[model samples]
Target: MANIIILGAGIGGMSAAYEIRDAIGKEHAITVVGDGPVFNFTPSNPWLAVGWRKPDEIRLNVTEPLESRNIRFVPTRANKVVAEANRLDLVDGSSLNYDYLVITTGPRLAFERVPGSGPEGFTQSVCTGPHAEKAWLSYEEFLKKPGPVVVGALQGASCFGPAYEFAMILDTDLRRRKLRDRVPMTFVTSEPYIGHMGLGGIGDSKGLLESEMRQRHIKWISNARVTSVEQGKINAEQLDEQSAVLKTHELPFSYSMFIPPFAGVDAVQGIEGLTNPGGFILIDEHQCNPTFPNIFAAGVCVAIPPVEVTPVPTGAPKTGLMIESMVTAIANNLRDVLAGKPMKARATWNAMCLADMGDSGFAFIALPQIPPRNVTKAMSGKWVHLAKVAYEKYFLRKMRKGKADPIYETYVMKAFGIDRLKLEENID
Candidate 1:
């Protein structure tokens, strides 16, 4: 029997554990290693930051559910990944060996890339549960003395959805509190345009997002690289299409939140042939590492190049639907390999997002995620916001029960008339 170890118990990790268990059954042992026992619904972080959702509402004790599924749970951080030896060294000094390993550790918030940014610095973050909670606290303090607000993603940042979501949510909250008049909001982003979103804008995303911002009275600065952030001030260089600095702006704000760049966690960095320079795991179409076939990766930890070059550096996003496809593909491939069959399953790499803007929201889907896609759709309305709320609850419930349901495949794909996984023989 093979000992399969899955690292990181967030969305991708938890789903992988359940899917692999269902795929392989009782023939093998499955273990999940995570730094903590709780799993935070990361997509809901923007809502949590704005007081629309509580911490408990988005956090779940994953130990019980995973254990109930007959999966071993190790609540400890990994010190290092000894890939050559097929072993992992835990922070507690214990070592665990595995026949196969799946990495879903997600990205490490590279806040240090920008000085005087992140929670420890002058700016706030909604990347994690604790970070969002901190952002809420800081936001409450700022509410007492409302001033200018700044929100956007920094250079080399990958996930741009949350940055947009939080900005709009903050606007909705302030308007509800009758404090919108007192606060001047500005969006500073590395994207060349307002809705490039790293995938070069899906459907009418640019026009839709731009229209929304205009209607809400939120000003924006595109192709911006934050040079430094001070206590109440942020310095940025606006770049032209040729990557030349066109102007430098010294903006002042009482509240600020910027999505910092992401890198692979420390545990998996600097291993030859294991990860890219940015520390993200290097996987082929099958989601298996090129150098070590026994190793696989999914979620934000997987390396994907930017869709297109921008004036300022930007990384592609790995949306929930995209990660789900990755997890499913990995599980199916593992099952095939364990059965003495060649690995054939491949993730669709599709992208879908329900970006809540408090009162309203925007939804988009990009087939195959990369440019020159077969399909792309985008829309905005209040129903999208409601759908996001429902989706959060559904996802949390799925995690709590350890169900191996292909949610995106069943619901989302059916709605859009698409498929989730493609086999090697089927790919042209």
Candidate 2:
């Protein structure tokens, strides 16, 4: 019997655990190591910040559901990982040994990159549920006396969707309360353009987003590198394609949300041969570490190259669909390895994103998220907003049931011509 250890019980790790449980059954022991007991529906954090979702609504006690599946659950921070010994040091004064390990611990928000950024700093964040709740409190206070608002991403930052979503949602919320006219909003982003979105302008996204921002009366500054943040103010430099500063501005804000750059968590960072310079796990096409064959990774912890170079450094955001596909690849390959069979499965790495714009939304599809792909699409409508809401409910329901990918989700993907795996037969 093989003992499989999966680290980080967030979206990717939980999805991997469910798939592994379904594939390998009860014969093998499955253990999940997580930093905490609750799993937050991260994509809904923007809603949480605007008082649309309560803390309980977006969180699930992870232990109850996983224990029901006959899986071992250890809720503690991982202190260190000894890859060579196949041992994981935990915060609870114990270590777990495993034949195979999967790391899905998400990024460590690099708020320190800018001197006065993040929730603890002058600016606000909606990256996590607690942060979102805090942001909502701040939002409430802001509503009392509306003024200037700034929202955007920092250099070397991925996950631009949430930043964009939060901005629009906040705008909608303020308007609903008849406070839009009292607030002056500005979008300052590391991306070279309004709709670059770290994927180099997905299907005229530049034009579409620019138009939408204009319609919403949200002014923007792109290729902006934020040097520091202060109380009700931000200092930033706008750079050109040549990497020369074209302008510097001191923008004032009553509230702000900046997506900081992400790096591998401290537990696994700086491990020679295990991670890249940025501390993200380096994996082959199969999601297995080339140097540590028994090690695999999924989600934001995995390193993916920037889609294209920008004047201001930007990293591509890995959409949830793509992360789930990575889970499939890693699960299949791990199953093969433990069964003494040749491992051969690759992730589709497709990007299927639904960006909620409060009452309206936008959806984008880029097969093989790295660009130069076979499929590329971007659309917007009220249906997209409704679809996003439905997905949140369906996804949480699936997580509660210890199910991986549901059948209806498959049909939805099929309608979009998306498949999770890149099998040998399916590949050209």
Candidate 3:
């Protein structure tokens, strides 16, 4: 029997474990390695930062659920990946060998890319559960003495949805507390426009998001590259379409949060033919490594080029739906490979996002997640916000039960009339 090892027990990792178990059954051994025992629902981070959700509400002890499914759980950090030998070196000095390796280790927040940024620095973050909880504390202190606020994504940042959600959530919270008048908010982003979102804006996303910001009284600066961040001040250079510096702004703020750029985690970096220069695993359409076919990857850890070039660097986002599709494809392909059948499954790479703005929210779907897509739709409403709330509970329940249901297939596809996989050959 083959020993399959899945690394990084986050959304992609967890889903992959369950799906692979269902696909291959108990004949083969499945192991999941993670940095910690708890799994944090990353999408709910923005809500947690604004006091809309508590830490416990979004965090789950994944060990129990995974163990219940007969999947071995290793709660330890990985030191390095020995790609040539198909082995992994653990921080605890123990090594594990596997017949196949699936990498789902999410991005490492590159806060150091900008000096005086991130939780350790002057700015706050919502990238993880602890980070969001800390941000809440900071936000509470800032509430006592409200001042100018700054929120947006930095250069080379991939995920932009959370940044937008937190900005609006903060606005909603302040208005409810009758402190909105005391704070001035500014959004500084690397995107060329308000709603480019790294995929070059879906449907009328530009107009919809811009209109929302205007109505909410939130000012913005696009094509911005944060040069440095001080205790109470931030310096940025606004670039023109030609990549020339249009202007430099010295903005002051009492509270600030910026989505830092992302790179591959330390363990998987610098391996020849294993990862791109940025440290993200390089995968083909089948989600399998080109040089190391036994290795596969999904989620933010996979390298995907920017949809289109911008004056300032920006990376395309791998949304939850897209990641789910990738996980499903990898599991099915592994099953086929083990049976001596040619790999035929391919991820649809569809992008679907629900950006909650506290009182209201925006939703979008991009088929294939790349430019020249077959379909694109974006809309906004209070129902979207409610839908997001329900999704949080639904997804958490699924994780706890170790259910391997394809969320896009069960909900999104029927709702939008889309398919989850684009297979070249038929498979039972």
Candidate 4:
């Protein structure tokens, strides 16, 4: 029996477990090495910050779900990866050997990049369940006295949707509390414009987002780099089109949330031939490292080039749908390898994101995430918000149910002309 080890217990890794189990069947032994015993729906974190979602509501105990499917679960940090040995060393001084390893360890928060950033600093974050819960507490205390609010993605940050969602959601919550009028809101980002969104403007997103921000009375500072944050104030540099700093501003704020940049986790960072200088795993189109055949990767941990250069640095986002597609491809490829068949199947890196903005939201579809898209469209409405919430509920249920690639999910992809595997790009 082949031993397959999947790293990280987050959405990508868990989904990989379910998909791999279904594809390879009982012949292979699957062991999931998760950083923790629970899985939190990360997309719902912004809702948690606004008190729309509770901590318990979005978390799932991954052990039972995984063990029930005959997958071994370990709740420990993966310290280092010895690629040549095909083994992983855990934080608890234990080791696990595997025939194949799937590295899905999501981004390590780069809070140190900017001094006085993150929750421990003057600003806030919703990157994790605990961080979201802390943000909620901070918001509650701020409700008593509202003032200027700053929310946006920092330089080198890839995930811009959550920053947008948090800013708007916080605005909604303040309005519900009748405090929005007292709070001056601003969106600060490294993107050249309001909705570049790290992907060269996805289907008029700039226009739509700018219009929405204007309607909400929210001002924006684009092409901006936050030098640092201090208590009750934020320091930033607005850049010109030529990527030069145009002006420096010291803006005061009663509250703030900034999405930090992401890098590879410690487990695989700095490993020769496995990761790039930024510590992101280097993989071919098939999501496998060229030097190490048994090593595969997906999600934010994988190295993806920025869509386009801008005045300030910004990284591309790897959406949930794209990660799922990668998992499907990896599972099929591994299954074929074990069955003594030539391995093929490559992931279609398309992205469909539901970006909620309080009562209303936006949805965008981008095929081949980088650019020159086969399909690019965007729509916005309250229906989009409802759909996002529904997706969260459906996904959590799927995780708990231990079911992978449900029929309805297939129909959803077919409607978008997205394939689970790259049929044309399959390797021999």
Best by lDDT: 3
Q: Compute the lDDT of residue 53 as modeled in candidate 2.
A: 91
**What digit string (tens of lDDT, one per residue) describes model 3 on residues 283-389?**
99999999999999999999999999999999999997889889989999999999999999998877888889999999888876787777788989997788788
Per-prediction count of colliding residue pairs? 0, 0, 0, 0
In model 4, where do residues sit more than 4 Å from their true spots? 406-428
Please give each candidate's TM-score: 0.96, 0.96, 0.96, 0.95
Better of 1 and 4 by lDDT: 1
Candidate 3 global lDDT? 0.91
lDDT of each: 0.90, 0.86, 0.91, 0.87
Per-residue CA lDDT of model 1 for 1-428, tens digit only, reads: 99999999988898899999998998799999999898898889998898888999999888889889999999999999999999999999999999999999999999899999999999999999999999999998999999999999999999999999999999999999999999999999999999899999999999999999999999999999999999899999999999999999999999999999999999999999999999999999899999999999999999998999999999999987888889989999999999999999988877888798989899888876887877778888997887777777777887878774665753364443444443111221
TM-score of 4: 0.95
- True lDDT of residue 368, candidate 2: 57
- What are the clashing pairs of model 2? none
Candidate 2: regions farther than 4 A off = 406-411, 414-428
Instruction: Note the residue pairs that clash in candidate 3.
Output: none
Candidate 3 TM-score to native: 0.96
